[model samples]
Target: MAEEEAVKLFGTWRSPFSRRVEIALKLKGVDFKYYEEDLTNKSHLLLKYNPVHKKIPVLVHNEKPIVESLVILEYIDETWKEGFPILPKDPCQRSHARFWARFLDEKCLPAIEEACLRSVDREKAVEEACELLKLLENELKDNKFFGGETIGLVDIVASVISCWLKAFQQVAGVELLTKEKLPKLCEWSDEFVSHAVIKGCLPPSDKLLASLRAHFETVASKELCT
Candidate 1:
């Protein structure tokens, strides 16, 4: 008889990166034990598994650990091979998806975070963010999702913008993603979050908002002390 494959995930609820791993695992229909790590006092298992980065969203499969959310997402897609595909099968489409996913992480997310959270030179930050978002808006033109009719790699990577951005904007009193400014992106966000797989995986909006509010307050207090 074959031995059962053991799967475990170390993550935190408030982290979008952590949420990304959960979404991928659930999407691929992989059953995994979840260990919620305290960011302030990280677990020993987390440290042991991810010695280098010491980050959350570490996926352990049959004792082999995978770090980095994007890497884990790809790993999950490749390993499972039973559920709906995460990345497109065609080489060209796969490359395009990878490019956009990287863009979401490296370019769009940072710009949006700065625009929503910046305490200095707010105008310039918002302007830059808006410009970047316009590019995304154009990319999403007329498609129900970045993955056309269904959710895919780009949508998964951009989940932070769809869900976390709302809390960020509320806490910072900034409205970076709006229906008026970027209608297509706004619509995409709405539809993205509404999906059955995504809706359950995301943190509750009210709880998330309160947490961000407390976090920003703590940061402000520390800055004032400094």
Candidate 2:
């Protein structure tokens, strides 16, 4: 693709969904322009492109918009299918990859979001969060990555969990994915984040922690004063 024909990604720094697309682009060695969107006041282009959900992490290829992080991931893979494959070539392995990716979306992502955003029952939320982490720990026990030895589709999806989990731990004042509790999963996270592409795409840990602290405090104060 020529310089003008290159892709353009609309996203936010803190959004893990956006980060997924960013990492995929870097992994595939695709040239693209990044446009960060402010969720508070979303840009006209974002609204115009994704009018339905009006969400970030929209990828524009040749000016055609693709929404949803996972959907965009599949699109990226298919578009540059020749390069480093994110999804496996074998039919069974590809199905397994999709299963885990969907699992992260259906189960893991929601649990983390609830733990971070909902404050009606703080203790219950933290407990539920730990349960989800335990399930992940079991799934990751023997596998180096969700796709086995190398990082793949499911690995990318699961990687988002760490960022949110870290935020939750800071806000709730509890450590769930510790060395002693979920050793392998914790180790996997350490290795996953160490990848140059993923590491460069992630937001600063301190900044994410501070944002989570402020968000939880705001939610907690509002609930108490109400």
Q: Which has the greatest lDDT?
A: 1
State the TM-score for model 2.
0.91
How far is 154's C-alpha from truth in model 1 (Å)?
0.5
For model 1, the stretches where C-alpha displacement exceeds 4 angstroms are: 1-5
lDDT of 2 by residue, 1-226 (tens): 6943569999998888899898888888888999989999999999988999999889998888999998999899989977778999899988878887887789877876776677567568757877877877787768788767888898788777656677676677666677887788888898898888888888898898888788788888988998
lDDT of each: 0.88, 0.82
Give per-residue CA lDDT, model 1, range 133-198, as digits (tens).
Answer: 788778887899888898888889889988898889888888788998988899899998888989
Query: How many backbone clashes are present in model 1?
Result: 0
Return the TM-score for each candidate structure.
Answer: 0.95, 0.91
Pick the TM-score winner: 1
True lDDT of residue 181, candidate 2: 74
Question: Which residues of candidate 2, in runs, are more than 4 Å off?
Answer: 1-5, 116-121
Pairs clashing in candidate 1? none
Model 2 accuracy (lDDT, Cα): 0.82
